[model samples]
Target: MTSPSQILLVFPVGECGGAESVFMAIARHLDRSRFEPAAWFLRTGPLVEEVRTLGVNVFLHPITRLSDPVNFWRTVKAGRRLIIDAHIRLVLSSLGYGHLYGGIAAHQAGVDAVWWQHGIASPMNLIDQLAVSIPAKMIITSSRVAARAHVEVFGMNGIRLEVIHPGVEIAPDHPDRVASRQVVLDELGIQPGKVVIAAISRLQPGKGQDIFIRSASSALRRYPQVMFLLVGSEMFGMDRGYELRLKRLAVDLGIEDKIVFTGFRRDVPRLLEAIDIFVHPATAPESFGLSVVEAMAAGKPVIVTDVGGPRETVIDGQTGLIVQPNNEQQLSEAIETLLANAQLREQLGRSARDYAGAHFSQRTMIEKVEAALHSVLEADTATKAQRHEEGR
Candidate 1:
């Protein structure tokens, strides 16, 4: 029997974020029979262990300060050696640093390098852009918006760009959803008949949690039964006093009683089920809204900023309402509209679920990734044959 192709997946951070989550999914769901998967991470954390549980090998290589000439050449030499020693037939990098360090190693080792750019957060510095121009087999973008950014800004070919929208899974029980809602509400001391409005993302400035709170303050004046949920925490527990800032704002707004901050809960699926409405009001352009899709999968009506990948995910009048990004008044009005019309909410919720299931499923993402791998492999084979013919 032929051995499976060993593929090295390089992602610097071994932590859960939007990009990391998608990388984890790819490692977990890759066609195991044909591909042997392993990962390289800079540091170990929750995400590293999670990948290990998926039966993928994880290696730690602290790649530091590549801008300095000595560090750059030393790391590149080490990366090249690592790829060769591991017998890595295909090399894939997620995020900026990984693309620079990992792609360098793969290029020198005579292997095809694939780059996955999930969002704008992984800004391409001089080193990163140098790596991109240097010879990549494929550049996988997570959204259409990202694909355009790469082409217009970085001058990449559309033919080489592969866009795979992010995906999430839905829990399969309605009764359990009701029970979960009750459990969460009880824990929060929220009374029955309170409408839950949740903004589910890391407590960061760009995520627009502050925007949500400001909108919720206005929303509370009109709808007193509303309860706002802020459902995430910053990485490394380094919130940069953002949480304190939010609390202070909440107190000043006089809607402190209406808000609930559940910092980093493992029960996201349960919370999504319990939440009445999902709001993703990103102050900046969101590459793709994973939380928004997860909420839609839970059969909740969503209101997302109309500026980025989130806009593409939702059909404004059908799946969810699209309001301008960073506009508190527009956001509040959208939320209030959902609150007042039960029939509209239900209709949008159902449509959102159907759209999410069909368009953004784990299976759909896995299949697209599988196809990309085969394309790269086939292209490599054809290129080698062409070289042999030219020599003759």
Candidate 2:
């Protein structure tokens, strides 16, 4: 029997952000009988240890800055050596640094490369230009909106772009709903019977936590029993003082007592169980809205902005409600509508749970990703054979 092909996965960050979580899911669930996966982290953090616990080989080579000439080439050399030594058949990378460095290493090592595109494509930077110029076999995006954004910005050139929505693990029962809600209420010193509404994302300006707070203020006027949660922490100093600003905004809106900021949670699934309603109000176009799908997997009715990937996942009044981005009144109205109608909430939650289970389960995502990877390898092999035949 032929041995499983060795595939090297590259990540620019070793922190468990949404993109890193997607990478970990891939590593944890990939089919070992068909492919053996290893990882190289460009920056070392908690995620390196998390991946190690999964029993996948993890290599940490801290890259200070990719812009530095010496730093760039040295890391490329190290990556090339690792790929060659591991007999890597294909390189799959995440984020920009991963694409640029991993693509170079795979090119040098005579292997095909693919990258996960985790952001909405914007104006091309120098790094973006360089990364896009690499001869990667595929560029995998998590949503059709994201894929279209890339085409609008870069025009794809000749690269193959595949849309693979992010997924969550679906459970047979919501066993923790009551227990998790009690735990959160006790932890936050809130009394019982209050409805929990939450927005889960890092405290970034683009994440629109302030908008959530503003809407929460409006919702509180109608439903005094509603409690709001902002769950997640800032990362990489990108949103310095952003959390403080959000807190101040909540205070200014006179809803500080009604909101809880659970910074940097590791227990998102449990939190989702505690949540009665989930909200994602990103000011910018989100790439995939992993948290929105996660809430759906938890059987929670969600309210998301009609800006990006979340709009595509929800059927607007069927699966969940979709509101205009940054519109505090619309968001508040949606929240009030759900809170007023328990039957509607239950119906939407059931539909969302069914939709998420059928289309966005981890098993489904892994199957799609595995097929795409195999197709890339097959196409590369066919191209090589054609080149050899022509040369002969």
Candidate 3:
């Protein structure tokens, strides 16, 4: 058997967020017989140490500011050297900034680059243009919405663009929902008989915590037995004190005590088991609704915004409800609809669990990613052979 090809995974930040989770999954679960993966983190944080435990050589080359041209080129050179020294055959980068850093290095070292777009479907800016300038072996997006938008923006023939949903683990055996719910409720001092609705994401402006709070306020006005849980804390210094703003908003709406802000809990699946409903109220479009999928996997019915990945993943009146982005009235109605009807909640949750298991399992994601990597190398070999034949 041939030796495993060395692959370098590049990331913009080494934090445990949605994108970082996908990065970790790949590093941990990739077939060791075929590929040996290493990681290069642009900024240091918690995940760097965790990645080291996976037996992957982790390199920290911090890029504190994106605008610093000197630092940018310096890290690119460092990464290129690593790529060359390690004999990296392929470089996989997360998001656009990572593409800029890793893509350029891969090009310098004469290897294939594959970029995973983990954000919304939006018009490409100058930086985005530069990031995509380095032709990739394949561009994998988290959702079809993202892939189509990127295919148009990158002006590709859609041959190299692929849609691979980021995966979440679906435990075959779940903790008793009643017990889990009581544990969370008891810990938080939330009384029994209250239906819990949760919105989980990093505490950032466009993530729509304010919107969720307002909807919760409206829903709670009619239904007194419902409690709102806003899970997650400010991550990567991106908060801009948005968490405080959300809290103040909750207070202003007179629903402060009705809501619980469970900032940054690692027990998301357990928390999902504790909640009756899930909401993803992103004001900006999401490339893939990872939390939404996680909730579904945990057998919780979700209410997600209509303009992005969540809309694609959730079926209205089937798996879950899809409200218009930033629409408080619609969101409030959806929340109240589920709160008022336990049968609908259970029905939607069952369907969502089935759909999530079929589509977004960790095994499915790793297998798809593995196949994509193989295809990239295969295409590269084929191209080299074709060139050799032409020369002959």
TM-score, candidate number 3: 0.96
lDDT of 1 by residue, 7-106 (tens): 8888777667777878888898888888888988765678888898898888876655555777767767877887899898888888666788788788
Quote the positional error of residue 315 for candidate 1 in Å.
0.3
Candidate 2 residues 1-392, lDDT tens each?
87878889998987778898888999999999988899999988888999999999998888877668898889999999999999899999997668999999999999999989888887755666678888788999989999998899889788899999988899888555687678967887778888899999988988888889999999898898899999998986576889999999988888888999999989898788777899999888888899999999888999999889998899999999999998999999999999999999999999999999998999988888899988988898899999999999
lDDT of 1 at 228: 93
Off-target runs (Cα >4 Å) in candidate 2 are 124-126, 174-176, 387-392
Clashing pairs in 1: none
The TM-scores, one per candidate, come to 0.93, 0.96, 0.96
Model 1 spans with C-alpha error above 4 angstroms: 64-75, 121-131, 157-159, 236-239, 389-392
How many clashing pairs per prediction, in order?
0, 0, 0
Encode model 3's per-residue lDDT on 1-392: one tens digit a residue: 89998989997897888999999999999999999999999999889999999999999999967788999899999999999999999999998889999999999999999999887545646667777777688889999988878877767744488899998898775556687779988988799888889999999978888989988888887897788899999988885788999999988988989999999988898788788999999988788889999999988889998867887789899999998997999999989899889999999999999999998999999999999999999999899999999999
lDDT of 3: 0.89
Ranking the candidates on TM-score from highest down gives 2, 3, 1
